[model samples]
Every structure is written in structure tokens, then in C-alpha cells.
Target: MSDEEWERFLRETVKDTTGAPVEPSARAREVARRLREHPRQAEGWRTYSPARPRRRKVWYVTGLVALVALLVALFPQQIVGWFGGDDGGQDGAPLAAESEAPREAPDAEPDLRPTLAEPFRGSPAARWADGAAGITVPPAKATGWMNAAQVERALKQSRDFLVAAGLDSDVLRGERPTKAIALLNPHQKDVQDYLRTALSSKKPDPDTDPLLLFSRFRPEQTRLVGDVVKTRGRLTYREGKRGAVEVTADVTFVYPVTPAADSGRDAEVIRTIVRRKVVMSWDDPAKVITEPGTMSLVSYALDMTNGGCSGPTGYFVPPFGTADEQSTDDDRLIDPYDRSKPVDANDGTTSADDDCATATRS
Candidate 1:
């Protein structure tokens, strides 16, 4: 085709691709027309035009080729990935495998030892409700005065005693009337330390009163089954010339697990501090029974003979002041895993000495 025709064709094609007409300068168009008009002159066109150096063209071509090569090199894996290849292993699953096999939920921490519970003292409802608030007096251990049938009769008669004494009807309605000892604030360390100290010794002081054992709700072990937890406990009381004394206030505490705080540590803090206050209260000499014989009896009741140490296991006990008895939700509640070995409570498996004593001795 003629150079002018070729130029017009180029213009139309450019317009089609770029949507704009290609325009050659007037001088360039005239030159292209003259060259095309003379075949001989067109043949000598390269000589007159003085072609660019071969090295420059080579460099330009090399630069374009290198650019294309670089693009391919940079995304070789991506190119292969478009066609589906192992090199790009379906969305970096290989990279994930190379990094670390998903950190397994860091080995779960070993659970803490489960605590035991105190026996239920009063009616089921009463034991669950006024657990640590009910009053207890020394029970006359006069077996000769009562049999099963007579005890049932006494319990029926006790309803009048309960009303006169301002006790709850639930406490008197049961076949057996139970006395409860509720401790305000008993020290945990003092109770544990006292038990360890007293139990280690065979001959306790006649003048020294027995240590009173009391139990309260531990938030860590407790669960919010419904609105309230059913707690059961036993308190060893003794009487003397002084007054009624709580020799041992060992009770099972049942309460809801207060939810965790926003920081996730509130539950832990509550469980640790709640029982501590109760333990410290029992340490106070002024509030505790001071009669020598009564104290001795309290101590003996908590002694190994009574099997008091082998009480409740894994009972839910939340500390007081954790929450109003009305609040319900597990949002901030503290829950603890039970590590207490399954026990045959029927076979007196509660004795910690029975379980761990051999381990310690060996």
C-alpha cells in the first residue's frame, strides 16, 4: 500500500483503539507522500534518513524484553497459581504449615485439688437458705430420752419451739430438728493452721477450748445451678459455765459463681479473699467460746476420731459480698476445675490422710 494510505490506515486503527485520531505533522506527511510517490527514492530512504545506531535499538529491545522477563519472574508463582499448582498450595496453606502447626491450645493447666463439704445440718430448704445465718445451741446428746419414734415426736413438738425461738418453719417441719452455727467472719488460715496444729498433737490442753470449724461458700468451686446453691454444713458446739461456743464451725458453702470482671480476674480474687475473712473471724478470742472444757470438746469433735476432715468434696462455696443473692449470669462468674479424686464417701474415703498420708509417708 502507498505510504499515505498506510499512514491513513494507522490513523484509523489508532482511533479505533484509543478513540482519538492520529495526526502526523504537515512536514512529515509531505515527506511520506514524496517517498511513496518515488519507488527509487523510497528504496534510498534509509540511507538519507541515517538510521539510529544498531546498539541503541538493541538496547531498547533489550530493555522491553528485560521488563517482560522481570514481570514474569516477579509473579511466576502467581502465574502458576492461576493455572492451579502445588507451588501456590491453595491459599498459603503451605506457608501456614511452614510457620507452625497451629499452636495447640497450650496444655491445659492441671486442675486444683477439690475441697470437701460439711454435712447438712438442718432441713434441705433451711440448710440451703439460712445456711450461715441460723442459730445453733448445744444439743442434749441424751439418747435415753429419745428413740426414732420419739425423735419424730420431738421434731413435731419442736415447731412450737421454733416459733417461740423465732426459727423458720422449714427448720422445724422436718422429721429431725437440726441446729446450725453460722459464723460471721472466720479466718481460713487460722482454721487450717489450728486444725493442723491440734490434730498433730494427741494430748490437747484441758483448759484450751477446741477449735471451732465453720464452712462458707467458696466462689471458685461453686456453680450457679439455679437462682441459689444448696449448701449443707455442720458446726460442733459446746456449752460451759461461760456460754454456748462454736468449737468447730465446719459447714459446706453453696453459692453462685460470681462472674469474672472485665479483666477476667475478679472471680479468682473473690474466691481467695472470701474464705479468708470467715477464717479470721473464728480466730477472734472474744467471739469464740472461751470455756476450757468447751474448747476442748470443739477441738476433739474436729479431731480425727469424728472424721470431720473427711467432709464435703467439690461442694460449690462462694464467698459472701461477692454479689447480691439476686444477681444471675455467668458473664463474670469464676469457675474452677475439680481435681478431687472420686471418693467413695460411703467408705470414709474423705480422710485426706487416707488418700495422701501414704503418699506423704512413702
Candidate 2:
């Protein structure tokens, strides 16, 4: 691994091992700089001061006065013997009274020393610094696709925020607005087309009945909590300019749902199957990684398996797809219109397949 990669790995490893997140302290940095500049003295010596008298008594007052007089009078050695100062004035005789000027108060203690060990710098993943939640805003100005990833992440965050505010769950699906509108307004041709493809695509078998089939969907209600970005691209000065790009998504949001009547059963089943939800968000290639050679486009797929609405789920939807797919029990697949001929299993059915020459077309 490169040095940067190694550093990042080390940082992440440390962060994981220690639950406490390491933060950069300006004070720490400054202290470190000072330590490097002015290291600790080799002597490592410290001086002791006499404790101040809490309450003065007649004897204490008299003794203090006598000691001061002796110290000033060039009899410091005698005074040391009389008191408890070991080797007091041993280094040198008290400066001649005339030459000894009052000492200025010792310089205030320097700021506390910084840590001896290296400062702990967290990894980029652990270093995600979100702004105060709920106070985020749209970009102040359009900076072009240079920050496209940031924009998409921001849009998702915004969708989450709106959902938390009780706007609509479908909006956060990251599909397109048309598909979102179609979910509620199936009468629209766009909505009809989506329903036809999603719901009418297939049919179920004779004995078993199921609840839902289309597996992927975007929650209608969600909100954005925070965002940050790292980029390696040229900032646009005018209308059009482009260069290398790198973007990341950092977001957090909440989804509200009423408690299921049979929480245990729902949990078990939801965890087992994946369901689909509609979305109305956009994707910016600069911010998202995708297969090579595919131009950015609306509509995508999501695997809801493990814990979707009813069970683990997954499916593909076009830009304006709807939420009208049928649900069934078991794995039978049949014609959506006739419900007679078997087409596939688990997946939904659609209109007759007239394109097939060998098999009877629907």
C-alpha cells in the first residue's frame, strides 16, 4: 500500500480498536510545535516553595519577622541553621544587600506541555465532520459538475430531511420526480407505464397468495443530516469546464414507521426478503462509482433483500416506474393478463411476449 493508504489504514485500525474518536485540537497542535521548538530542559529540575500560612499566630508572626531580618542582614547561613533550610545560601553568600534588588515575580508558568507521543490523526472515514445537524442548506451557488457528487449527496440528505419533516417517502428513492408522482397518481400515462411494467409484468399461481413482488423502493420520507467532500478537479470559472473528479457521500437520516402489530413476525420476514421502493433522487457520476462507459441516467436498481418492506427484495425500475407490482406466495410466475401460461418464477409477469416465435406469444 502507498504511504497515504497505509496511514489511512492505520488510522482506521486505531479508531476501530478505540471507540473514542480522535479529534484535532488546535491547542494540541500549537503545543506540539512549541515542544519541537523549545524542548524540555535536560536538568528536569523543580523548585519547592514554602506553604503559605493559613492562620497567623503570635509565635509564627515573630519567627517570620526574625527570619526575614536575618536573611537580609547577610546571616542567611545562620538563619538556615536556626530554621530548616538545608544548605541555604550554600551555593553563594547572599548578594551584598546593596546589590541585591528585589526579584521580579517568576514568569507565569508556560502553557501546559503537549503530549510526548505523536498526535493521533484520524482516518478520512473517521474524520467525517458533519455540520450541526438540521441546519444544513442548499449550495449557495451552482459550481457546476465539479462538485456533482457533493450535490447528489446533498440532494439525498435534503430528501432525508424532508422525509423526516413528513414530506413524501418516494422522493428519496433517488429515481426521478416523474416516477415518484406516478406512485400516487397511477392515472398518468407515465404512472401507467410504470405499473404495467412493474405490477402487470407477471402473475401468481393457483393455490398460494402473496403480498408484494416488486422488491426495490425509495422511502418517501427521509432527511439529510450532514455532508463533506474531497475533490481533485478544476473549479469552473464560467459555463463549461471539466477535469478529473472524486466525490464521496456522507449522510445520516431517520425513517419513521408505526410499530408492527406482530413485530417479531414482521422482523423475521422483513429480514428474510427484499422489497422495492420508488425513488426520485439523482445520481452524479463524479460522486458515485458505476460500471464503465455508462452515461449518467435516471432509474437504477436496489436489492431490498434481508429486510425490505415484507422481506429481502431487489428489482429494476425505469425512470418513471410505479409501485403497482403484484405480490404472491410460493415461486409461481404466469401471465399478468391471462394468468394461464407460466413465464417465470418469483418475478412479476407482463403482457404477452409477441416477440418470441417458437413459444406461443401472449
Candidate 3:
């Protein structure tokens, strides 16, 4: 065919394959001229060559690889999640966003020991008692006889008696009424008998015997005298089943605990000043008994740092000695009323010695 006819034929063939009319651009015309010049070679194009197919396949594979790499970089977490690997974030969440999420905080510890307030005397007494001794002078009549000075004197007498008796003040410091009663028995036979009979009764009540109130309550285990900072007393007369004059003493002191007891549990040792009330009843205003007994133990109450009072455990009785003889193993007992002489320890042996002799009783 002629050059012009050959170009027209090629354009028509391309238009048929592409389904569009071909424009004769410079490049298209040049390609057409080359095909026309190589007619013998063009005849071979009728049979397909693997060269074009191979090149197309190579480009397709390269594009697919680039797409996969982009997906891996952008959705690493999501890819891991699909394959059952830990994605860190919750289900279906993006890793970048989940990484910046805020976390919840843990709970705090609670306070075990709380702060306690100082004790006061005006507070209600812990224990009270009405002895077997009949009330010859009832509370109403005894009011005229009782005064602050008289009550103060009575309290001092009681303090002196305790110190003189060499009573285990530590045991008395606790709440044990029975132990206290036993300790007082040798000294105050009348008081001891009264307490035993009253406390052992089937219907023992604080109302009947005020000292029974300590059955459930007690002061802290500590030194009572050494802690005493101040002491004051007042006389009160209240009418009840039996009339009696009441002498109340308020003692203020610094509550102390052993260094070992106050360790890491508390940052610093806290010694609090507290006040306690001691009440005693006088059944007969006419009779002049010893200091503490003249005013019987009616009520004794105090505040404790740790908690309630633990009653008396036991008492230590010191051995007695005389100029004529050596010391004996037998415990020297004394009458709470008369400290001048030493009595038997309920055991039959009674050996009076110089140790039992003291100027206070004389």
C-alpha cells in the first residue's frame, strides 16, 4: 500500500481495537511510519511474543509490593491484631491513639491509730461502792459535816496510806477490783469484808455497791503517784437507798508509756496530761476512821491512752527484818488502818520486826 494509505490503515486498526477514533499526533504518525517501513517484521506481530506480557507482569508485581509495604507501615497494630499478636490497645483501636491514653491510679492506705483527747475529772466515775457498814449519818445529814478542806485532808490521808502500806501501786492502777480488795484486806478488815460481801452478792449492782461499777471498766496500767501533777478534792452529799457523804478527788497527771511500747507505731512519743476522779463514801460522820477509809472508795475513773483499764494481776509483798533476827521468806502484812505493826500474811506466822516499824503510824 502507499505511505498515506498505510498510515490510514494503521489508524483504522487502532481505532477498532481501542473503540475510539485515533488522532494523527506527531508521535503517533512517527510510530505509524516505522511500522509501515518494517512491514515484514510487522507481519510477525500477528503471532503473540512473551516480551510484552513479561514486562506487564513485572510492573504489576512491583506496584503490588509497594502497596503492601505502605499498608504495613500505616496499620501495624491492626495487622498484629488480625494475626492474634498483642496490639496493646483495646479491640479495633489504633495503636498510636491508644498509646497516649491516660491510666487509672491505685488506692491509698487507711489510718490505723486515731488521735485521742485529754481526760477530765468532771467526767462520770468508773466505779462506786456502798460498804456493809451501815449509814449512821445519811448523805442528807452528812452534808453539814463535809467541806472542801475536810475532803482534801481525807484525800491526803488516803494517799499517805497507799504510800505507807507499800501496796503494789501498779496492781491497783489496773481495773481488777478483786485484786484490789485482796490487797486492802490485811490493812482494812472492815473495808475488805464489806467489799467481798457486797461484790460477791448475786444481785451486785453499782447502785447497791457503787464500787461494782469497776467490774467492767478500769484505768490504764501505769505509775499513779509519780504521774500526779495536781490534786484537788470536793465533798458531795447525794441521797440514795442509803444516805452517805461523798468525797471526790481529782488528780491531774502526765500519762506515760514505756519507750519500747511507743516504737515505730507512733512517730513521736505522745505524753498526754489527763485527770482522774476518785470518790469515797462516809457512812458515819461522827466516827473518825483512817484517811482513805473515813471516805470509802466510792468511784475511781480515768482515761487511758490505748483503751480500757486492765485490772490488777498480783501484788508483791516485801520481806520483813528485825535487829535481833535475819530477814524471813514470809510476807509481812500490815493493817491498812494501823501501819505501825506488821501482821501475818493469812499464814499463821507473825514475827514483828524493825522493818514493820515506821514513824508515820506513830
Position 355, candidate 3: lDDT: 30
Residue-level lDDT of model 2, residues 4-54, one tens digit each, is 999999898877876765886999989999999999756434855577866
Q: What is the lDDT of residue 74 in candidate 3?
A: 95
Task: Return the top candidate by lDDT.
Answer: 3
lDDT of 1 at 238: 29
Model 3 poorest ten-residue lDDT run: 126-135
Residue lDDT tens for model 1, 1-362? 99999999988887788666679999999999987897563445455666677798789999999997886688765555455442312121111111112222112222232121211111122113332233232243423223345333332232222222123233212111223212222233443354444334433332221222222222333332223223222233223323332233322232223332222323232221111001111122454533211112222121111111222231222332433132223333221111122112211112221221101000
lDDT of 2 at 122: 15
Taken over the whole model, the C-alpha lDDT of each candidate is 0.29, 0.29, 0.34
Residue runs of model 1 more than 4 Å from their true location after superposition: 1-127, 134-230, 233-250, 258-294, 297-362
Candidate 2's C-alpha runs over 4 A off are 1-49, 53-138, 143-179, 182-192, 199-305, 308-362
Per-model clash counts, in order, read 39, 49, 13
Which 10-residue window of candidate 2 scores lowest in summed lDDT?
116-125
Q: Assess candidate 1 and give its lDDT.
A: 0.29
- Give the Cα error of residue 230 in candidate 3, in Å: 6.4
As for TM-score, the candidate ahead, 2 or 3, is 3
